[model samples]
Target: MSGIYIHIPFCKQACHYCDFHFSTSMGKKEAMVAALRKELLLRKDEFKGEVVETIYLGGGTPSVLELHEIRSIIDAVYADYKVAEAPEITLEANPDDLSTEKIKALSKSPVNRLSIGIQSFFEEDLKLMNRAHNASEAENCIREATAYFDNISIDLIYGVPDMTNERWKHNIDKALSFGVPHISSYALTVEPRTALANFIERGIVKNVDDEAAQAHFHLLVDTLQAAGFEHYELSNFGKPGYFSKNNTAYWQQKKYLGIGPSAHSFDGVRRAWNISNNPKYIKAIGSGELPMETETLSVTDRYNEYVMTGLRTIWGVSMERIASDFGERYRNYALRQAEKHVGENLLYFKGDVLLTTKKGKFLADGIAADLFMVNLS
Candidate 1:
């Protein structure tokens, strides 16, 4: 099934480690909303009449907007697309932005899922990341959100320099105690040009230790699995029937239309992304033009994408689908490459499905590339 992703590129404040497209200045919030509505109408047929099963409101922070602003965008989607009945509508929010009253109001809207950015529950961790919310807000917001919504996903970050093994366990325990159905936990990586990176260069903040990150990764798997959470993806865990449907659809290569600045859209063959600059996007859209660039995927590129995404999930890539889509040459090449990894206890074959073992999950990205078929015409 296809889905629609709406990007809200505005944030209340800049996180030191965030590299996502977002502006701390919200002067263009109103104008950007109007422009995005126009952009949605302009790209209405991108999905080619597929029934949309999901609509995700993601961004710098979608929860920062007023309830009415969110409603207006949903109203626009209804006006233009054939949305499925009881679609999984999700909005990404921060802990500080979600209050009891706000959650109560959001429950009244069409949003059925909440993805809260509760990165860490430790005050020091929050300070290091420069998250606007404190530890108390993170704890209370989840309690407040569960009161109104049953389908809730919270994000937690691990591997910070100050996050000891015991502290990491505490973070996982906090999420488990809250009875959160879904969680997306990530390791802290310092991207280039970010404030975190600069701090490291100046010796202000300690650099991230890869060994520490790897240790925490193992800890995450063991702890969550024991607590009855399935490791569906490398970075995601969920109880039965609580896995994220929208993200699953994406990993399976379903078509989705992404609206708003810096959003990416894919429809099997073509991929497009809107401009990252807010002012430029607004100006271009106001002039009745779509400010986006398109790329046509070659066969090799498509196969590589399939391998990259399919291998990351519990459901591995199918040998039959690979043979049909990319011919025997590419298929046999993949199988032969996987043989070495399989012998190393990193991957295993179940019938035709090629699944990675727990030992291989952390290195999935590197291995996906090793099997990639490059320069194929």
Candidate 2:
């Protein structure tokens, strides 16, 4: 099913490791809300009558917005699109913004799910990442939020420069204690130009250790799986009936309309992204102009995307789909490339659907790149 992703490009504070398109300033909040509503109306026909199954509020920090501002955006979506009877409306939030009063207000809204950004449960890790919330707030918010929402997912980061295994375990245990249905954990990658990157360059913060990250990944997989969380995607673990429908739809190549600055949209054949600058986006939408660029995917591009996403999620690439949709030539190319990895035990075929083995889960990205049809015409 198709979905909608709304990017809220404002955060209460800048996280040192974040490089996503967002502004720390809230001066343009009102103008932005109007612009977002206007942009939604502008692109109402893009989905081509497909019923929207999920509405994801991702962002600079959706939690930073007022409850009324969020409701206005949701109202705009309903006014413009054909949404499903019970769409999974999710709001990405930070612990610091999810106060008791705020959670109570959110429970009465259309947002059925809450994805909290709880990078770590230790104060030192929080300080290192410049997270907006302290360790106490992280724990307190989850405890309160769980009482109001059932479809909750929390994000945890592993492999911080000095994060020990014991501390990492504590984070996981703390999360499990909350009994949240889904957990999205990722490794700490120092993106260029981020404060974390600069710290490393200046020798102020130690570099992330690959070995330690790898170890942490295994720990995470084993711990979560044993606790009955399905390792559905490489970086996502969810119990039954709780896997992120929005993300799953995206991974399955379903079309979606992305709203707001730096947001992306795909209608199965063409992909587009809006201008990243908030001021430019607001001005353009106000002027009745869609500030975006589009690209139509070639057959090779589609095939590569399928391979990359397939390798990361539970739904592995189907050999039948490869031969039928991408042609025998592309199918043959995939088989030829997969042979080496299959022999290396990093990849295996389950009757024609190629899947990554547990040992190679952490290396899925690199292996998928190797299997890509780089120069195919």
Candidate 3:
């Protein structure tokens, strides 16, 4: 079974540290929704007679759209694609958009999961992140939504300049109190062109320290594991059976078709993505053309991608599979690299499954890069 992702490229406001493709303007909301529906129908044949096991409505803020708009997109997917009998449909929403009435409405919709953007449950942190919702809204929305949706996932950010360990612990504790089945947390990162980066460059805001972030990560892992949530992926923690099916499919390298501006898609080995422009995208789709770029994966590209994603999850890269798919030369290069790290205890082998140690999890991305064979074809 394959997956489908729909990107809603509009937001209510800009966050300080976000670099994802989005526009704060709502001028094109109606047109964009139409374009998205058209795009889904246009790409119906891409998945090649496969059933859609998961449908993810991600975005600039999918919550900004009206419930009818959201359902229209789901209806288009159902009308044009072969969806599973009971697909895991998810919608990424912000706290402010999830009013009591809206949550009740969503309960009747096809969305079975909610990935809410609750960056923090504190006023100061919310203000610092330039979040649209305040602390009250953050807490209230979760409390109300939990009554309606059993499968809920909320996002939390750590390593912000003033977020002390005590505060971070409190944040995690508050999230746990909600009985949320899944939590996806990440260290606060300042992208090159984001507002946070400019503030740091001008000494208006403090920079994120790697050591502090690492410490927070350790605390997060311990806290969640103690609560019976699995550290399934580097940045994800979930109770048993509550892991995100869509993201898991992605990390496992399953094929998915991304619909809408700035979305991405994968077809086993090839990769493609739409342009990060609203007007341009709308015009192209209207003209029966895809405003995007595609790349057929080279052998090295595929191998490196495997190493990158495998190391981040509970599933480790398989030595035998690598040898079969990428040949002995690439496998030998990986083993040689693995040999050095294994000695340092960064990565360990369970039979033939090469997995990362707890200490290696934070450095998994770097370690994966070290194992990449740049010269190999």
Candidate 4:
């Protein structure tokens, strides 16, 4: 099944650690929305033969848009493409933007899922990350949102500098208290040029400790698993029947069309991304130009990607499929590359599927890199 991802590249303010492309100004919000709708109409043929099973509104923070604006965008999708009868429509939101009135209004919209950006429920952490919402708003939004939406996911971040193990546990516990069916948690990494990185460079903030991050990840897994949450992905936990259909489709290498500035799209063979400049993207779309770049995936590229994404999820890499899809040469390369990690008990086999061990989940990315086929013919 195919999906559509709409990137809303506007936010109320910039977060210290975020490296995603977005603007703090809403000056072109109206023009951006128009561009997005037009871009959807312009790209309808891309998914002409495919049924859209998910429409994910991600961003700078989709909740910043008005209900009417959000509706107009969804309406645009319906007017052009053939969508599934009950598509999973998700909107990424921030706590401060999700007022009780807004939450009530959204329950009546086509959006069925809410991925709240409640990164931390502590004032100190919130201030450190420059999150728009305070600790109370974070707790309040989820408490109210759970009353309206059952298919809800909340984001949490661990490994913030000075975030003790106890504080991390409290964050997870606070999220569980809201009864959200899904939780996506990640260890904070300071990307270059972000405020967090600059802070570290100037010794304004302590550097992220890898050992502390690893400890937080283990604690998260144990606690969530005990509380009946499946560690479905390296950074996602969900109850049975509540995993994110959109994200799951992505991990399985399904095709998706990304609309709006700085969005990326993937067909079965090629990947494309829109330009990141907002005004430029708006002008290009208005002039009926896609303003995007495309690349056809080589066999090696596809194999490497599959290995990377597959290892990060519970659906480990399939040896037989690798052999059939990329030939035995590539399959043997993978097996040989995986041997060291397997010997270390970081990777093990379940029948023909190569999966990560509990001790290896936090290091999945690093281990997957070891299995990458860089020079295979």
Q: In model 2, which range of ten residues has the least summed lDDT?
A: 41-50
Residue ranges of candidate 4 with Cα displaced over 4 Å: none
Instruction: Give a tens-digit lDDT track for model 4, residues 1-377.
Output: 99999999999999999999999999999999999999999999899889999999999899999999999999999999999999999999999999999999999999999999999999999999999999999988998999999899999999999999999999998888878899999999999999999999999999999999999999999999999999999999999999999999999999999999999999979999999999999999999999999999988999988998999999999999999988899889999999999999999999999999999899999998888877764
Clashes of 3: 0
Instruction: Show how many residue pairs clash in every candidate, following the order shown.
Output: 0, 0, 0, 0
Which ranges in model 2 have alpha carbons more than 4 Å from their true place?
none
Give me candidate 1's TM-score against the actual structure. 0.98
Model 3 Cα displacement at 297 (Å)? Answer: 0.4
> Which 10-residue window in model 4 sums to the lowest lDDT?
368-377
Backbone clashes in model 2: 0
Name model 1 segments beyond 4 Å from true.
Answer: none
Measured with C-alpha atoms, the lDDT of residue 45 in candidate 1 is 75
What lDDT score is found at residue 176 in candidate 2?
100
**For residues 1-377, what per-residue lDDT tens digits would candidate 1 score against the true structure?**
99999999999888999999999898999999999899888888776568989999999999999999999999899899999998999999999999899999999999999999999989999999999999999999999999889999999998898679999989989998989899999889999999999999999999998889888999999999998989998899999999998999999999999999999999999999999999999999999899999999988888999999989999889999999987888889899989999999988988998988988998888889989987686
Candidate 2 lDDT score relative to the true structure: 0.94
